[model samples]
Target chain A: MSITSLPETDRSVPLNRNRRSALIALAGLLVAEVVLGSIWKILPQNSAVSPNVFTALMFLMVPPILFFIYDAIWGIKSRNSKMASYPMMLIALGVFVLGTLWTVMFSFTNIKIIPLFTPADWVKGFVGLANYKRLFNTSRWMDCPGLTKAFQSGWEFKCAGALPNMVTYAVLSIAISVSLGFLLAVMMDQKIRAEGVFRTIFLYPFALSFVVTGHVWAWIMSPEYGLQHSIRALGWESFSFDWIANRDMVMYAIVIAGIWQGTGFVMALMLAGLRGIDDEIWKAAKVDGIPAWRTYIQIVLPMMKPVLVTTFVIVSSGAVRIYDLVVATTDGGPGISSDVPTRYIYQNFSANLGQSLSASTVMLVAMAVVLIPWIRVEFGKKSQA
Target chain B: MANTSTISAEPSGAKPKPFITWERAVVYTVLIVCALFFLLPLYIMIITSLKSISEIQGGNIFVPSSNPSLAAWEKAWNSACTGLYCEGIKVGFWNSIKITVPSTIVSIAVASISGYSLANWPFKFSEGFFTILLLGSFIPYVVMLYPIVIITRYLGIFSTLPAVVLVHTIFGLPIQTLLFRNYFASLPQELFKAARVDGASYWQIFFRVFVPMSVPIFTVSVILQVTGIWNDFLFGVIYAGPTNYPMTVQLNNIVNSAQGGKAYNVDMAATILTGLVPLTIYFISGKYFVRGIAAGAVKG
Candidate 1:
């Protein structure tokens, strides 16, 4: 509603009305939960629990209640709150909390904890790092048909040491995505003709989902019907580039696709930084007869450090979460040569149900390793500044 | 260094030609080569999409001699098989639009309110709340995905249109909030104070005073959120359900399925088709790009 022109005397009316509506919403939510729970209690145990309908209902309702409680408490303190005092905040918060609780409860108790909570019996079977250990410790990974076929007959398969192919994929892809992004950004910053067109071309890949870009790249890199084969037809007799198949080279192939998708983001960020540069410096540099290369190296590079850092952080974040591209491109194959952490997590959660928790643990650890430093730097910068 | 000083000292004598002259032709040359390298994949994608599958397998990818055909396009649009279904990415087009539109609107709306509150209202907890929101942005969304999936399922909307939209909104919140908040914070405080003095209430001030002035930032927000939600595959797949799969998911199935030989022509055609919406948005909104950034939402 209109919040700007509320007379001082009338402000309390809307505030009170909002609070009343919030309470009603919260109450309605509670009643719905109780009704669903009662219905759940009445149904035959087998039928009732099958869909986890009761748990789902509770999960849906609890978020608004929690949010209502939060808003009520905050409302009392503020006393003149408007829409903020309503149940929307409570709903969002409630859903988040209830969802977490339901998921956790379902994992431990085999019973349908809630309709919304999926049965996690398979995941609960393996606690802690057991699943992780099994994944990393297996020699059978090399024996997978996808892996063997991708590597061809002559190649020797290396046993995974600690992390699986997926985790390695995430790490390597992220590194390549961010670094190449930065390099592209720096290159784009140079004063050149057709810069706009070049920038668009670079960014065009970002517009396409990983599914589209990944598939296109997969085809281009395919051995039989791809660019490699086309090149071979040009009478380059000894030319055989089977990157998508070679286990050692598979990650690089994925990285090449990633770089193609990512460099545009970096270019945009860097160009933003470049345009923000104070013109006075350039004029001063020219006046001082500073060589163009030296100006960029010594002056401009240092100045764009913040933009560079931001780009690196953003790109790296996307990199570590690599999943869709790998799935779309290689399906974690030419055997698991191109598996990334997210893909591994997805596989466990969806297909290898028994290993879901273990996969999550790996994902959590990988994310923490990358994120902790970033969070620290972010906070450090704010506090220091 | 001596020559540099001489040029500066002789500002009136003869403007020492532009700094980026033909002597710096190497820079242009390098950029041109880089540009070509960058454009090569796109060229391959377009040409491959236009060629027949037989022609695609026949010879040189760079060579356009293979008979150009719309067969792949027709397949991509109308009849590519994704599992039991033979309908193409078109099946997911409306669903993607449904998920994207609401998510974008609600996200931009909530972010505006939150951002406005942070910028204008002197609430005691605003900064703390904003800080937490900022921190939330850093959490790898993948970590949150499982948790969110569980949460959404618990909410009984896990594989529904609303579930996907909600997910998008939640994920989009931090950046959207940050963008608008920063943008609002940069605006002159006097205007806000003046509006309040003129008896403008919070909502009025937001709509009449703040929003109208936020066109540039809004354009930026639209571009960012639209691209993100429209191109998203994972969330769309998980939350949007099979009934509401986005084009990207369909595109994935068509291009990535492990069953048979790779279909290069159809795959490229589908990729380009699915990317069209965002590509169009980018092209149409080209003029807004610089203005969006210039409004200083990203300024450090």
Candidate 2:
């Protein structure tokens, strides 16, 4: 954040006279309320002043608390407008800070269905690591039991939920989409015809939601009547694209659609990166007699390292949050074979709060891991510059 | 926009290359193939939606519909079943509009102001909150899912369009604020200082100075949010309840739910209907889509 780039601190001006007096008056009233036993009882018991906890809180806390902030740091004569953002900052803190911490803290308790935070509930419900344990070895959380060799027969595997599935989805989606996108970018860089047309075509799928993409691709890949049937009707009797029905192959189906939807955006990003590269680099490579592909591999890719990392991080983070696509296409189907972290957290939200919370906590961790380094590089460079 | 670079093994001068060269052939073949692959789904959806169910089930998907019709589209919009409620997906469309309009306006208004504040007025530890907001964009919804539910329920607006609206506004804050913040920060600081020196209020400066200068960023934020909130299925499914499901959620239900024998034509029609809004937005503002990403890319 450009903390060092703040404008020069101007001379402090005194507070506006009326506003200062009003603040002082409010502060004095708050002090009196604090000292007095009951300001509410001053009115007739049946009178207009109906003192409840909320109004009392508004009276006793909000004014004095806001006054402290103003008088302490910001209530200066010079800066009249900066406090306009205090409410926005307050909201950001509530959503990002309180919401996150609330989720993490409750993740430790046995909040099986709904959160109950009474003192007795805490005594009975605090179960450390219990939810985490279930996330791995339990029935719906067992790291891809489909491939564990126990469900080799006609057995439908219990989705030992989010574990390696999320990892697998993230890795595969990022790797496949990024490479495919880079290849497309290099191809587009050849000064091809219909460049804008091709760009728009590639990115149109990115515009659609995963639900649409999932269903269309589901129809396309389903063996019942999609590509498989169409190909067979066209005399390719042996062609089969039944990945959605197969357990281990379902992830690929999702990833293929994911790549289709995402690769276009990545290509767009990379194309932007490619365009930003100075033409002199290409001229130098030409003078050195390096092949074009070699120049790209050795020079261009390295130069686009920041863009590449950002794209990778982007794809990876999006992949980890794979809920709607999975829900739309297979719905964790072909027998719980393609369960992801997000779907797992959602499916268990009401059934098992602890499971959902702990799983969400893990997702929070996964998100942090993906973003921290990118943040450092992105904002760090700015502060320095 | 094309930057025609000189090749290593070629003449330095700009010369017209042979159109039928082997490399040109390879490149065109690859590009055309990719274009087709990208175009395949849209093509399939259009034809499938137009074809009769009998044709879709029995005939090849690649072949154009010999007897194309809008019956499926009519059914999808007029009478498609989503559970026992067979009033069609149009309900979702209207609900989507209802949700999207308010969310887009409120989110943009709040975020632009916050962005203006963060960029112009660097109060103490404001950077700290901005960092949290930027980083908060990366937080998965699963973490905030239950907490938002509790909050909405507490506010007595659970399972309603308002809840979804609030959620979109909250989630849209990080990126939208970032877009405006970075845009405002890039502007000549002299303008801001000059306004302050002239005794302009925050609203005065935002409306006159900042808003006048920020049309493109505003457009980008609008495009991003309209498409985003339109395409959203998760919040619509969870927070909006059954009565307020967005088009995406209803489309999924219409396609995946098996009541009678599956109606591929109607499903495809509903799919196209759901996708039409975003697809149109993507085409109209495709350049801004990419530009917005580049502006908000991690180098920020």
Query: What is the docking quality class of candidate 2?
Result: acceptable
DockQ of each: 0.27, 0.43
Clashing pairs in 2: A13-A77, A14-A77, A140-A161, A141-A160, A141-A161, A142-A160
Error of 2 at B57 (Å): 1.6
lDDT of 2 by residue, A9-53 (tens): 442333543456446656765676665446655757675333553
Chain A, candidate 2, TM-score of 0.78
Cand. 1 Cα-lDDT: 0.66
**Which ranges of candidate 2 are over 4 A from the true structure?**
A1-74, A77-82, A117-124, A144-160, A379-385, B1-16
lDDT of 1 by residue, B16-132 (tens): 667576745765676667677678877888888888767777767888744688888888888887777888778877778888899999888887787676655635545655665
- lDDT (Cα, tens digit) per residue for candidate 1, span A1-385: 0101111221111232346755776778788887887786677755614346677557756745786766655543332232442322433344333433433443333222223233455355325444445655454332243455566766664545224554455566666655565556556555444566776776777766787778878887888778789888998868888888887778778777887887666666666666667768988999999986788779988886655555555666676667788887787787676666666556556555334434444554555576565555445555564
